[model samples]
Target: MDRTYFVYMMASCRNGTLYVGMTNDLLRRAYEHREGLAPGFTAKYGLKLLVWFEQYETAHAAISAEKRIKRWRRRWKLELIEKLNPRWEDLYPGLVPGPA
Candidate 1:
């Protein structure tokens, strides 16, 4: 099966604490963060809202994007999120398998 990878960012709130990560399963990983199943920075900082994401064909590319985003200044990161999600709305609902 073909695999897809994602470099995503989660935030506690608009312009709040942010967390950048990469995952092959964006929905599952985002769910884990929402439910506090994955321990560490995200859970500790309440960064459970899926704010931004980019898909990649290769894991290497996803990882590289995640790393690059993580190193970006807070202003840059915020701008990135705003560009795609101006309201900073939680994107987790769209990823879930259910009625929209």
Candidate 2:
């Protein structure tokens, strides 16, 4: 079976700093930090909020996009998100498998 991949955006809080990464397991990865199971920049910087994520068919493609986005200026990244999510809301509230 093919594994699913995700290109995710995480924020410090509502509109704090943003971080982009690619993961094969979006839920588990997000949960890891939410539950403090993972450590590093995200956990250290308190950037556990899942603001946005996009599914990709292949990990390779997801990773490629992630690296490209990471190279983008902060202004560019914010503009990209604003175009899709004007409010900069926490997208996980709706995408996560739970109540709102």
What is the alpha-carbon lDDT of model 2 when measured against the actual structure?
0.80
Error of 2 at 80 (Å): 1.7
Model 2 RMSD in Å is: 2.2
Off by over 4 Å in 2: none
Tens digit of per-residue lDDT, candidate 1, span 1-100: 7899999999999999999999999999999999999999999999899999999999899888889988999999999999999999999998878865
- Using TM-score as the measure, the top candidate is 1
Where is model 2 poorest over a 10-residue stretch in terms of lDDT? 91-100
| lDDT of each residue in 1-100, candidate 2, tens digit only | 9888999888887567888988998877888766667788788888777777778998889989999999999888877777777777766656568755
Candidate 1 at 36: error in angstroms?
0.7
Q: Candidate 1, clashing residue pairs?
A: none
Q: Highest lDDT: which candidate?
A: 1
* Model 1 bad stretches (over 4 Å): none
- In order of appearance, the predictions have TM-scores of 0.95, 0.84
